[model samples]
Target: MQQHPFQISRKIEYGMRAMIFLASQPMDRTVPFREIARRMDVPEDFLAKILKTLVERNMVRSTRGAHGGYALARPAREVSFLDVIEAVEGPVVVNVCQDGSSHDSCKATGSCTMYGVWKLGQQRMLEVYRHATLDRLAMSDLRVPEPAPEAPTRPAAESRRVE
Candidate 1:
């Protein structure tokens, strides 16, 4: 059986949730870690580690002492889903060949005819992820704003005589 590489860790889920929570709050407010943990229903310690990783990636900012916790380093619109995923999970890659390295070791590496197809699929997947941002994800209503009303048009005199 061919083992598929690359899976999104539970940490990625928790990290995204934490980011959304921060995005929903006041921009300048520092939410408590425990509060985020409780709200997200994620294990406190595990979520803390995820948060630490986010901080190191500069995706989130941490504050110390009372009334301190975490907040997004940038606006939600400025952060992409890819950013959140990469923050906790590292760079995304589906296959060994997609990593752009020498394919000399494995007997089936270069000879595999499906390598190009797999690489193309990986690129498409990345493009989709790149376009999906946290702000778009958080916006529950997907309606387009209505256009401004136009000036009323005058009816032709002949058309007004229909009565």
Candidate 2:
């Protein structure tokens, strides 16, 4: 399926999911990648890459050996959604015009038809993502609801409909 232009990449999504899971845990505790993958329904291999990036960015800390795992590098409130996103996917620019300075080609503000709308929207997007931290997300109840478990349904037998 075609993705929306504004949609974040899976790496970003999984990275944030892992972050929230880590944040939910006690700060001092290091949880294993297997656990994180299971809980978040993310692929372990892919999650490993995302966590490595986070570790490199100092947003997450990792430990080796059997007793080791991963944990947040700082308090959840100290890390913003933008921080995780930029860490995983580089700067989050909505458009080329949203980046650069006065006129390094595609300036921040412009006279193009979509420039004003995209610029204003980009500014708002930046502000929202910058201020919306992990702790704040944890406090909010906006998670996708888990689907209810259902009993397995048996296929109709050949004679079931025959009176």
Candidate 3:
């Protein structure tokens, strides 16, 4: 069987992480690519490409000079997750039938059994992502401490017999 088709691309993941790191910095502060790459553990070239796309999308600003760096084009709170993800991954098409158009309904498919389910699920997903801004994410990251590295797990024992 084919592997699941719906998976979050690594580009989107890295872009989001980079944004969070940038958002954690002061609004007026600009962070160099090297610093962001090191802190986020993303490859500098890969991150640069992602940042370039984000800059083109107007979600991030890039400066070139001896002390040049990157910063958000607007307040982190104003930049939604949808904006970042869309910049990296294009629109979020949860399913084949979830295209954004007036004529894009189950009617087009004639008889899709899961139409209602897909419609509701896709809308909820969009709403969640649309409202989830970087500021809220950064605050949550600040409040929560990073968990320690997990130790290697021991082998599982056989189940015991019931009495």
What are the C-alpha RMSDs, in order, of all predicted structures? 10.4, 12.5, 15.5
Residue-wise C-alpha lDDT for candidate 1, range 1-163, written one tens digit per residue: 5533555677888998888778776668898899889877889999989999999999999999988999889988899888999888877877777776665534697579878787899899888888888776763322223579999888798468665
Q: Higher-TM-score candidate among 2 and 3? A: 2
User: Which lDDT tens digits does candidate 2 get at residues 1-163?
Assistant: 9999877789999999999888777778889999889988899999999999999999999999988999999999999999999999999777786675543456433556787787889889989999999987762332334579998887779538875
Give the RMSD in angstroms, all C-alphas superposed, for model 1. Answer: 10.4
Number of backbone collisions per candidate, in order?
Answer: 0, 0, 0
lDDT of each: 0.81, 0.85, 0.84
> Which rank order by lDDT, best down to worst?
2, 3, 1
Candidate no. 2 TM-score? 0.79
TM-score of each: 0.76, 0.79, 0.78
What TM-score does candidate 3 reach?
0.78
Q: Please estimate how well model 2 matches the true structure, expressed as its whole-model Cα lDDT.
A: 0.85
Weakest lDDT window of 10 consecutive positions for candidate 1: 137-146
lDDT of 1 at 161: 64
